[model samples]
Target: MAVCKGCGVTLQSTDPNAIGYTPKEGSEYCQRCFRLMHYDDLTVSMRTGIDPDQIIEQIAKMDALIIYVVDLFDFEAGMIPGLARKLPDKDILMVCAKRDILPDTLNHEKVARFVFARLKELNIKVKGLVLTSKLHSEGIDDVKEAIRMLGHGRPVVVMGRANSGKSTLLNNLFGQNILTSSRFPGTTLEMNQIVVDGITYIDTPGIEIENSLLMDVNESDLKTILPYKTIKPQIFQLHGDQSFAVAGLARLDLMECDHAACVWYLSDKLQVHRSKVQAADELWRKHYGELFSPVPLEENFRVSTIRKNLSKMDIVIDGLGWASVSGQISTISVRAPKSVNVTFRKAML
Candidate 1:
């Protein structure tokens, strides 16, 4: 049986509704990959079926260098927890992708330091770290050099969360779009290998992020939610009580606070509506699908009350951007979809 050149699924002439179906013989790509490449259409949602633990187990048996790709914009959701414990013997190189989404004014050294600090906190050890951008060539050469120095005659395995730019990074390394890359998650259904510059590289299925808005929203809303360009931080001043509804997907309510500044780092297409704390609920109920557009299919929401005494911190909504809050003392409440993860961490500015 021959596997698809784009997505590593066994090709079959039968079963048009099933995965890996091809109408003709000797097709290079599966039906799903072919449509995605030609028409930008997704035939299946790869988020539900793939087993992440099984993927890790398969990687554990391989004797190759691991190149862990992560989305710099959605770093929290992109991370695969307990990776070091599972692949303890493997030498992992963390490649932070989509660096272009963040502002260029921020120092790259500071960003690297922030990534290292987070990795140390999570106990995830890496041989080295490289920040990359698909639109820029700043770190592409560094990635190649790192792979050459660290590969040591072993195949390089690329693995990361779904839609984290794994295939895009590989294409960048190859200087062409050899693999299937799309906005849809789970583009690579199985393991596919490619040889570039005398080095073997394997592309693996993207591990699904269970607690992310990316899984909850419709595919059409992705363009508005995911940042393709540098984000222009929208700063809001809060004195007593105010609430911000982030495109009906999530809401941030400042219950009580002294003079504070909340800087939002999100897609320019999204609308951030500010209202008094008392009127927030009414406003949401009145205009959730209209004025506040692009909400999840289900209206069920989970509210998390966070009290931050730190002078500076960030409230991160998985797959969505974060808001940096700075003040003496503040009590904030985040209301979002129950499945989406909401957490706080040190400000990454």
Candidate 2:
């Protein structure tokens, strides 16, 4: 079967609306890829991600060296829960992608430390961690060398959550857009195999995140939420009960706090609005999608309350970013779309 040169999907001329369709004979690229690459048009709704069970089952059965890609920005969403339990004895290499989106101030040592800490908490056991950036071609050679060293003449499997730059990283390493990659999630459908530098690399489908904030919000507002460039950390010293909204997608209401530090590490594309806790509900109910722009397009949201008893902790809103807070706030209440993947973990960074 002939596959598209851009994305490794089987080419066909029967259905124009279907995936990997090409009207012209002997076309190297699919119509979907052509439109995206040239006209910047997205003809597919990738919000509904692929099921992860098939991908996980297949990966668990492989004897290949696994390269697990992760997002530096939304680390929690990129993580596959119960992954360590599934593949306890596999040789795995963690690829932390989108390194260019982080500030230049972050050095290798600091990043490594953060990754290690997160991995430990997640219970993911990896042989090594490789940081990569498909945008700037940073750390590409190091990844290639690591693959060569750890692969040990076995097939290499590259995998990660949707939009984690798994396919983009491989494309950068080979200097070819051999796999489909986009800012939108759920691009790759099945597995695609290739040989480069005498190593067989399998590009598998991206695993779905069950409760991602990105999955619940409007598609048009995604560009604003997902950072295209480096992020500037917004740090605010606490005074009293304050409420902050991250776009219209998430509302962080600080129920109680005094002399505490609340630091937000998210995309600079998003704006943070602060108000008194008393006025939070009124403003949100009356001024949704106005002062709080990018409100949920259709999904139903729920109110979740978490008490920050830990001395230091990070509140993670899946698929968006996380906020680190010092234990000054007695309680933090979040109003977000249902299945938005909110979690509390020990402070990272």
Candidate 3:
């Protein structure tokens, strides 16, 4: 059976709606990949149906070296909890992708330290770590060198969360766009193998982030939420009770604080509206989609109250950007999609 060169699905000319469908039998790429490559169109949502546990099980049975990719910007969401325990005995190399998105002034050493510290906390062990950016063509050589040294003549498996840049990283290493990659989550539906410089690399389906805002929003809204360029932190000084509406997708309200500095690191396209905390509810109820869009399809929201005693810390909205806070102790209320994950951590900046 002929398989699609792009997404590794069995090719079929009979069905237009099914995956791996092509108008012709001998086409190199399926119609889905063709549209995504040339027209930037997405025909399928790989978020559902694919089983992540089965994917991990298949990986565990393979003897290939594992190359775990994680998005640097959405680090917490990209992490596979209990990954080390699941893939025991396999030599894994962690690739922190999208290093270009972070502010350039930030120290790389500090970033590395942060990554290692987080890894230790998560109990995920790796043979090595490499930071990569497709925009600057960074860390490709380091990845190649590490693979050569640690691969032990086995096929290399590339795995990570959806939209984590696994396929893009592979294309960067290969010096060509041989696989289908997109800003849309779940581009790769199956395991696709490619050989470059005598090294066999297998691209697997991206593990879905169950509680991510990315999963909840429409594709068009993703353009504004996912940062394509380096972020310029938006700094806000809060004196009293204040609320910020992040494009109607999420809300952050400072209920009590003496004085605090809140810095937002997100896509420049997103519009953040500032208002008095007393008026926030009325504003949200009155003009959610009109004034504070693009909103999620469902209006159901979950409010989380966070008491921050740490002088400097980050409030991370999974799959969305984080807000770093400093100064006096504060009480914050985050209103976001009920399914989305919101938590606090040590400041990334």
Q: What tens digits encode model 3's per-residue C-alpha lDDT throughout 1-349?
A: 7888888888999989999899987899999999999998888767664778878989999999999999999999988888888999989999999999999998788889999999999889899999999986799999999998999899999998988999999999999989998998888888889888888999999898888999899887888899998999999998788899998899999866567888999999998888889999999989899988989867899999878868898999998899888877468889999999997899988
Model 1 weakest lDDT span, ten residues long: 324-333
Candidate lDDT (C-alpha), each = 0.90, 0.82, 0.89
- Total clashes in model 2, counting residue pairs 3 or more apart in sequence or in different chains: 0
Top model by TM-score, which number? 3
Ten consecutive residues with minimal summed lDDT in candidate 3?
44-53
- 104 Cα displacement, candidate 3 (Å): 0.9
TM-score of each: 0.97, 0.94, 0.98
Q: How close is candidate 2 to the true structure, as a TM-score?
A: 0.94
| Candidate 1 C-alpha lDDT tens digits along 227-274 | 989999999888778899998999999867678889999999999999
Residue pairs whose backbone atoms clash in candidate 3: none
Model 2 misplaced stretches (Cα beyond 4 Å): none
Summed over model 1, clashes come to 0
